[model samples]
Target chain A: MAESHAHTLDEVRAAKSRALAVFEPLAAVVGVGITRIGDGYGLKVNLREPPPSDTRLPTEVDGVPVRLEVVGQPRKQ
Target chain B: MQLDSARGLKRALIETVLTPFVSVGPQVKILAVPAGPVAGVSPVQPSIAVGIGRKAGHEFQIAVRCQRRELMTGKEVEQIRRKAKNEVDVRYIGPVSKRAAPWTQLRHRPLQIGISTGHVKVTAGTLGAFVRKRGGTDPHILSNNHVLANENRAKTGDAIIQAGTYDGGADPADRIAALAGMARLRKTEPNAVDAAIGKLDDALEFDPRTIRGLGKLAGLGAAFVDEGTEVAKLGRTTGLTRGRVTAFELDNVVVTFDIGPLRFDGQIEIEGADDGPFSRGGDSGSLIVEANTRLAVALLFAGTEAGGENDQGLTYANPLRSVLDALKVDLVAE
Candidate 1:
């Protein structure tokens, strides 16, 4: 992961766009949310489960730090 | 990539990825997930969710929902991932539904589901759900204001009937409940719901657990719905029908009432299969629920009939959250 760095709202949004495009296809991934980490912004990728640290997912996309956040999908009753 | 500006792009991307699987054949029932955070997932990020199901006659059952077999091979799923610009956050779920059962004859006068019921003096409308006042055990009949309160023309203590007037309910023979409260609909004011409730004259005269075709009142859903949420409802005309939420945040809708045309705001819309409608004229007042969880989501009131066709046009509703707040009621759990 990159050390904490200063980021503008515009940069954070750009990161979201770039990250969304990069991760759109992986199955079981649910959503991409914006998050605030320390003084900079981070991207939170929601998934059905926690991905392995060595998975194809990147630690950063478009110069923004990314983190995996497990978000279980709603199931049929 | 402001969230607002990127919304359209994201929606298009998901649509492009799923378009092929949407209608591979008539056996499939698929809809686009709205661009928003998938509910129950943390951090409220933007993403799309797909709801898969099947429609059977008057009922849309979700028992066959999104099985792995229905979705096909892993290669196809991989193809969707690649086409989606590698934006891997797409979410999938099995959305299910239960049909509202038609009302049948019972020897007792206890109010039954799937039968005609409305304001005693007013014509008729479906008694969509049975509810209890917030913090109170007294049961009440929930329906559209137009049905129980005559579009704001009725008063508290007015008589309500099991078989609506159209079904010949009159005087004391069919008395079931009385108008207790109603959420007002305004012409110039922004309105989010069109709901009303009547207090049952006697608890023994009614059974709150059963719906006409739908088995039992499960419970209330805790949140708002995203596009593609599978839902079902029971009404007087249509009996029971199910479909998906096609759109939302509809402000500036002009609906016709007995008095005249009234404008409504912030409504949700549901659409059935291409072959038929999800609701009909007397279906207003039906309650929409998540097919699988049996959780309540919307109140079905107004619908459009496209080009004079007998089938329901498009069904519209108020989010259940707003309805509960406006009416000060809670779902009566069995």
Candidate 2:
């Protein structure tokens, strides 16, 4: 879900220098980043292409799925 | 009650209110009495006096707040003046008092947020907002860099709008930064810090115009939702969506897709049907803003392969608390 800009003067006044404005509202859930550093040491967000209904995730831009090798004995998450 | 007896009433009032301060012992006492006037009654006015007993060096004091009332007819009116030294903070003891302020019920925990970067052309579904790095006591606007811009270099006053929701303020493409750009994050190659921080240029711009409006500076990150907490957000292609937080502190996420500087997060999920949560394509960079304070919590990142039938609302978010700390900003009002 998305956030809106509907705060009371008192709420906004205190948040005067903190909140960022969002104009667009997409129908689906995308990326949420915690910027620690890449450009700066802070959280950032990113939106990318969605997977096709038939395709699984962890693929390259060309739609090639990835492979992984477990370093240690796998453990439950 | 007698004049001395009235003093007893004042003592009762104070002790009744500060019952939950933990530091205060139960031995505390207060007394209150009536000491005012009634327009249609006798000359004897009615009012309340409060008092507390003190021993040697340790002491106690009482305070009373009054209101106009028509309780009894005044029978006698006389001047009564008494003076006593005070021992504690007493004045509008309603707001912060324990009897007055109670703890809220716990509802929902943190959810994972999936983010995409059009510029980098990579997305990380397992990405999460690391709050511990910034300490638990921070509050500044927070989000992934890709959420703020297609390019990593947004100006300090660049407009950052939540494109995932129906916003009625200045366009997100037209907001200014209070701190420009200064977020720190941990290095992905090793244990590091890499996060973004922006100063809010305008504090009272979005405040509602009403008697009960609270116009203050508020930042994003640490955005949360309760179980069954209905909320929404707007993304690149999806427009606006709705869901609730179902879990928190989900870890051991490994994004298998990579594109040089770009990352394609394939394992994340949001608003799923049965194949995991969340819809896909162009829904990145959206902030999961909560309803009450309208604060941003999850940076719309990725969706899962599961559907609602299999618990589709497993969305991820970069908590706002860590972002606030990196910016050296205050997360809560004192």
Candidate 3:
């Protein structure tokens, strides 16, 4: 686990925007959010399943880490 | 050994080994017979098994260990077997940890929070909390639209019942409230909350500030909570469970509703603490509160089947402020 350099909330928000723009359009991607990575801020890309190996997901968005998480499809509980 | 003698030995073991630990009080169950075969003991052997069961996440491990060390040793078992003058195998079963039983589905008097409740047309869901119009004194029951309004199908004055229809609640007889209002669910557009309210019946009484297991509500929390914040909820299906904010400001979450697939934006995600689930079916209307402060954080509405670190699944919620604003009510808190 790596911690990002101290970044402002505005900077993280900007990074989230950029990450969502890229990930949200993909069919496997379900959600994108600003989450705590290590002790700092990063973008979490929630996917319905693991993306295809050919699919190129961003490792970082504007220097903020873009961590991928595979959360199953959400249903009204 | 004769069956009668074995029974006597079982009672004696319980008195000597289990009774002294009763003061520990962690929802333990002591059984004389083992449900399964003990490791080194033969199935045909006449064994007086002493089993201790505890619910997961309970703080009684040290006490259980002490009991095991003090009274369940091989020498103790041999001594007991010799005194009984029989080939009795005394086995010590585990302090097995399991989930809490579902008690919220039972019909309650005085309307307890976190019990089963729903619209007459719906199956069941949890009573999230109590709320009132800003500056108004009349209390209202708060829950999800799907719980109290049948996901926009219910009318303004539709009957809301305790224990819900799935749990044997019938309209008119179990009616506790009338559907007052709801934040309608949109088919195509993105939604923020799935909340509704019911006007409390004049004859009914409820504790405004207390949630079933979580105690008193402090007040409203911030609309947006940061990740890693510890939270808890008591619901119809799962009772009280704790978790952590796994993600916040989550966007583009698609939820499957009875109407159709609906899109939601800017939601919060929670993962159960200790690999347990925070919510389940019939738990759709639980209120997520900050663990320490007890401030209302979010209104639970949806969840995933199998994902995240929790073996059960991840839970999603509407920010409490958003739900209150959408419903035009304030939480009735002390």
Candidate 4:
């Protein structure tokens, strides 16, 4: 089995921070998180709704792709 | 399943099914697993998880936490499984209840943190910790708002007792502080804390340095708790208990109070030591601190319980920094 190289937790966090800094001001952004992707890591930008085509979030940061995720009203539990 | 779609399904299930069941039977939690392991079986199917707690247990396994499996029959389990409609796998885990219960006949001295303190009108809860108003000489006692204020039922200068009203502390014999301030809790909004402070009486011989079990006062950790950070607490019900922070940065956690259901965000959840629970009722006010440095971290509040011999339960708390900031107080340091 081949070992897959992955971004360290710190690196993933930095990418997330950069993504949040850019998209957090947008009205659609609700929260941002870092999660493991196939072999590296990706930034998950939570949105209030599906992002429009003109959303400011980039395709990648620090070699990590940014994934747009939509969230809803908070759950009770 | 995608996280977005999974959350939507969770919302629907809770609104239509779990909420009604919980309203009738308070000892259950419905968990939605978009994808995860269950009882060592990693089923790819998006499942609805139900944890039915009976008696408290030593091992806090989430797969099936029943105190006595015999208490829950095979028929009842099948009935629940049948109702799922095959859209999701219904996973049932019966472990012990982690609810904290009130202490019985425990004696505590005055002016000590980690002892009982509650509104004169209600059962006793822990004193939690002590603090001072920023730039002020007066010392204040910290605890849950439910303890000191009786869930907003108490007014300014309401009497607070050392041993809690449940332990027979009344009037001049036990009164030690007066309610000062509290953070308002909202039902639907994201609340950061359930906290209050009491002004210690000038006449009482109070010592803010020593906790009942963990002696000497220390500073607090303002940073967020990472997963598996070692923590401990001293309380009236269980004296001293230790655990590890299982998870944090949690949002939308619904905790039931006597007033009603309130949702909290950015909360920390602790899994207790193998021997027993880290806290119980009457321990709600206990200060959760880092075990080694004694760095005050979280304020112990709610736990779930079942009728068992161990009486162990998982404990939830508000971050110490949030509590302090919300109440505009600072931890008293040596």
Highest TM-score among the candidates is held by which one? Answer: 3
Query: In candidate 3, what are the lDDT values of residues B1-334, reduced to their tens digit?
Result: 4445545665676677444444344433221111111123222212233433332444111112222533455554555555555344344554444344357877887887788898887778889999998778888999999889887888998999997776668979999999999999998888999999999999798876677677888889987699889999988877899999988988888887777788888899998897678887788888889999999999999988776675578899999999999988999875
Better of 1 and 3 by DockQ: 3
Clash totals, every prediction: 20, 204, 0, 19
Tell me the tens digit of each residue's lDDT in model 2 across B111-223: 12221111112121111122222344322333444334323444455553321111111343433223244442222541111234333344413211110122221345343
Off by over 4 Å in 4: A1-77, B1-110, B306-312
The C-alpha lDDT values of all candidates are 0.61, 0.30, 0.76, 0.63
When summed lDDT is taken over every stretch of 10 residues in candidate 3 chain B, the lowest stretch is: B30-39
Candidate 1 per-residue C-alpha lDDT over B1-334 given as tens digits, one digit per residue, 9 for 90 to 100:
2343235544554466545545353232112111111122122211223332223334221111133444534554555455434433333444433233335211226765445666765556777777888889888888888878877888999888767665556757778888999998687765678889989886456666675555676888856576567888776766677787655554444566665556565577677744567776667777888777778888887766541122335677878888888999987757
- In angstroms, give how far residue B83 of model 1 lies from its true place: 72
Model 2 CA lDDT for position B194: 24
Q: Report how far off residue B171 is in candidate 4 (Å).
A: 1.8
Model 3 residue runs over 4 Å out of place are: A1-4, B1-101
Residue by residue across B1-334, what tens digits does model 4's lDDT show? 3344445645554565444344453323222110111123222211234432222332221122223355244443344434433233333355445354433224455466677667787567778777888888788999988778877778999888766666657866788889999997777687889889999888676666675566666788867686668888877667778888654554444566756767776677676766676666567778888887888999987764421124354567889999999988998866
**What lDDT does candidate 3 reach at residue A40?**
78
Q: What DockQ do you compute for every candidate structure?
A: 0.02, 0.02, 0.43, 0.06
Q: Interface RMSD value for candidate 3, one decimal?
A: 7.8
Point out the higher-scoring one by lDDT: 2 or 4: 4
Docking class of 2: incorrect
Candidate closest to the true structure, highest lDDT: 3
Docking class of 1: incorrect
Fnat, one value per model:
0.00, 0.00, 0.82, 0.00
